[model samples]
Target: MKTFTSPALSGLPGLRHAFFTRDGGVSKGIYAGLNGGIGSNDDPADVAENRRRMAEAMGVDVAHFLTAHQIHSPDVAVATMPWSPEARPRVDAMVTATPGLALGVTTADCGPILFADAKARVIGAAHAGWKGAFTGVLENTINEMEKLGANRADITVAIGPLIRQPSYEVGAEFVARFTEADPAFARFFIPSAREGHAMFDLAGFIRMRLQRAGIVDIDDTGIDTYPDEQLFSYRRTVHRKEPDYGRQIHAIVLAR
Candidate 1:
């Protein structure tokens, strides 16, 4: 039931952020409480309740809640009410300077990042999976917030619970992707127990990327999804052959 509200962003009274764990919902078994994804096998009622509670916890109306279709792309969307829950946009990042909107991102071993520049009243949330991160979702999200009047330097951000370095082993080809992008990133990977494979530090690489983006306020609580029983993990569930899995939610809201 632990909630991680980064001290880095806590000084911004105008912003609300929550890195929720698996403790507050009605879901059971693999999709236990607070499972918000309707796409999962969790009961529709449970999913609805999870979303309802998440919105309530953040003190925003459920309808003000916003998220993308989450294609793992770097695209960012500006939130406008007359909200469209029906037409999910094919994007993984969302930003808004407008008040009364809750920008959200879902994750299961992938990074969920919440950003805020209270001075400009701009906020953003991004789903930065490895693929999305590789494609520059973090930078794109910061760019979107800037478009809405945020200064990247002033924007405080917290990267929430995700798979950690030791828990994330990948093949050499995968390691090649980052090295290919920028040879400097090669240091983030180290040889794992498996042959030709290495353990990748996703959060560390993201921090480096954000730092390169000129963002100063950055931090991660270092919660690992794969080993943590509370947080949901797609990779963990898949390897276990579980029928379905739940998604952990990471959300931020601008005070009304």
Candidate 2:
């Protein structure tokens, strides 16, 4: 099967990003192939080798790849240049004005949003899980990109590999959180099987947030991680009573 990836990375002027699927790596068992999550129980050597392969594919220095601590918070990181791999930054979104530094973020079921403004020569990658989305991580990423000269109108945003609404059954408490965030959000939830559970549209909510930020070139590929066995899924893994799951990486680099 073909691995799922973001098309927004294609044809951009000196920019690169991939929504790497679960293929072409050394991790065995549940981690299987292309398992890039360092946080996962996958072997450190396998994880490092997988990261090296992704960097080589993106045409950047394997040493220059940067990712966050990812607390599911809304904080954003602005990269001045290549960050040391030894320093794990504690932020969800990474915006880079300096070229050639690949900003990487991991997701198993959360939305990995890639941003690029050809005119501004800027790119950003964000890990927006439910909590981060509710707290405005997407908005913060866009705002930080603008600080580096990307106009919202000129920026193109693409959301990659997520558990679609049909596969994402949430509890009433989850539905209530959005309703409390904004009554308009109540509409984003649809009735699901079983009482007190609703189907949440994660990608739709992401596009809505981007549109609200005035970026509407939304490319939602409709890839559902939970149902697709090729890629990993946190929820699906949990539902299957698995011990742990791998995380795919969404990374972007801008050439200076």
Candidate 3:
């Protein structure tokens, strides 16, 4: 399977992480290539086998590879052990200090952020869509990691693939939501070709938030999922009128 690693997290000791691409899996058609999204409509067996491969790559047992039932909320969960798919927490982010457990987040166009504090042996994975990022999922993930003995300054974050601003145009109300939250947020948007619409810089906004939270060691793969065929994109799928889309799994694990 193809995977991308960030330099900030790659040099860290005692942990493993990957920003998996839409490559190397058994699923066919729309769900092909490492579709680890359990909530997706792909064949259950195919999804399971794909996840097994991801878990193996992370050096964790398949059962220990955990992802939440993401709701695009700012909620965060702390994982102490493996949970069955039926029992996955309904949250946007997860943190764990426990070794042998992989914290994962599934995404198509949303941002997949992997975090680690090697000194504290704490790791986190957050699924940050526009709503989740605006509502504070990134901050919550850092706070949860702090609670697990991670110092914010010591935590290195790696942002994975997501739809870039050029491919992410939004209506007036979407721009209003961010500006209403903070007028300064208006800078994150630029005029789009369509009237009453603007291109939103999701990655830039995410980076701003992390900096505001005092995380200096941050690395972004800077891979835009929308135009990149190697990655899956929800918007791309929608524009094409496809029935369903695949999701790439990005995970981080503290070594045992």
lDDT (tens digit, per residue) of candidate 1 on 1-256: 5577787777787888888888889998889777877568888888888888888888888887776778878888888662766776779999888788888888888999889998899999999989888898999999988988889878898988989998999998999988998899888999999899999999998898899899998978888999998889998998999988998778888887
After superposing candidate 1 on the true structure, give the runs of residues whose Cα lies further than 4 Å from its correct spot: none
Q: Which ten residues in a row are the worst by lDDT in model 2?
A: 1-10
Identify the candidate with maximal lDDT: 3
Candidate 1 has what TM-score?
0.96
Q: Which candidate is the best by TM-score?
A: 3
Model 1 residue 198 distance off true place after TM-score fit, in angstroms: 0.4
Predict model 2's lDDT versus the native: 0.87
Candidate 2 segments exceeding 4 Å error: 1-3
TM-score for each of the candidates: 0.96, 0.96, 0.99
What is candidate 3's lDDT per residue for 1-256, written digit by digit as tens? 7899999898999998999997889888988788988878999999999999999999989999999999999999999989999999899999999999999999999999999999999999999999999899999999999999999999999989999999999999999989998999999999999999999999999999999999999999999999999888999999999999989999999888
Tens-digit lDDT string for candidate 2 (1-256) = 2345556657567787788888889999889998889889999999999989888887887888888888899999998866665687889999988888888889999999999998889888999988888889999999999999999988888889898999989999989889987899987889987899999998889888889989967777788999998788999999989899999988888865
lDDT of 2 at 206: 88
Q: Which is the better candidate, 1 or 2, if ranked by TM-score?
A: 1
Clash-forming residue pairs, model 2: none
